[model samples]
Target: MPEETQAEQVEPQPQEPETAPEADGRTDPWSDPEAARREIEKLRREAAGHRTKVRELEPLAAKAKELEDAQKSEAERLTEQLAAERERAAAATRSAVAAKVEALAAKTFADPEDAAGALDLTAYVDESGVIDRDRIQADLAALLERKPHWGRPDDGPRRPAPDRTQGSSGNGNRTPSDPANDFANWFKHSLDQAR
Candidate 1:
């Protein structure tokens, strides 16, 4: 094979015109320096505004969380308090009813000692007139001055005396005229008897 000469090695080349149309026929959007700069500034400002909004929202989110936590805590506390109150009320009711039942049993049996032995005092009375230990205890404690005993019917319960100073003159066998006063007295009496 002969060595190729320099002129032969150089290939003929064709040249096109310097002016040409863009492939998509569109100019660069950033060709306007001022407009491009303004666009960049606008983007920067928008980003800054977004950051500011985020900062502002952080505190609001935190406050919302705090409020939610506080509400949950308050709700829990209230629920516990309500449960405790209900338990207290139930206990009071049971005790009062028991006292009434004991008193009723003593009267019905006509023998305090025998009545106590024979009765499950809570079962003797209902809201209407059922006899139960709880009812007996409540009635005796509320109505009687002396504590009721089951040993023997030596004497009947001592009824409360009317206050002469208050001009209250009743046989004392009936409940007080004022419902609140009556309930208070009865509850106090029931508590004492239970103890």
Candidate 2:
């Protein structure tokens, strides 16, 4: 083994040129600064055109959103109105049923209160708000037949005739002296005798 001098160690070496590898045997456009700048400028122009299109459509998009909101609000208001109308109709139906029941009860029973208490409104009234009069009458008849006491006159007992002798003038079987005083005396006499 021999030691080599520094001049012999420093032998000239062959150099290769620096170059980018070609993809599919074609040059990349990005390798040229001018081509890259042109590509960037083209992209910027396309972007500007897109921005202009978006700006042009903005008002139409806003109008469409506003219209949709207005329609939704109107639909909500109509729904509320319909609900209110249905409530009013239901209340009116109930009122009509009540009036009919009260009238029928008054007609059927000696004491209207007794009839009102005994009657079932639900049984007579249909879902469509129609009342069954025949059913109501039949029910009333059945009730009256079952409870005979309910049909009796409420005005308790009758009073006996007054005795004329107690309030009459001195003559044993006398007529009043004046015709005008006769009616007045008879009325007074009847009231006093009854008491």
Compose the digit string of candidate 2's lDDT tens values, residues 1-195: 122244245444433343466878755546555454567668867988999999999999999999999999999999999999999987786666656656776755677657656777667778777888888778777888888777746666889888665685766686547877888999999999999
Q: Which ten residues in a row have the lowest lDDT in candidate 1?
A: 1-10
> Candidate 1: deviation at residue 91, Å?
1.0
lDDT of 1 by residue, 1-195 (tens): 122254345444443333344689854435444444567668867988999999999999999999999999999999999999989966776556555554565553445444454445445546664445455555444444343443345666887897754644565455447788889999999999999
lDDT of each: 0.61, 0.72
lDDT of 1 at 32: 49
Would you give me the overall lDDT of model 2? 0.72
* True-structure RMSD for candidate 1: 23.3
Off by over 4 Å in 2: 1-32, 108-129, 135-195
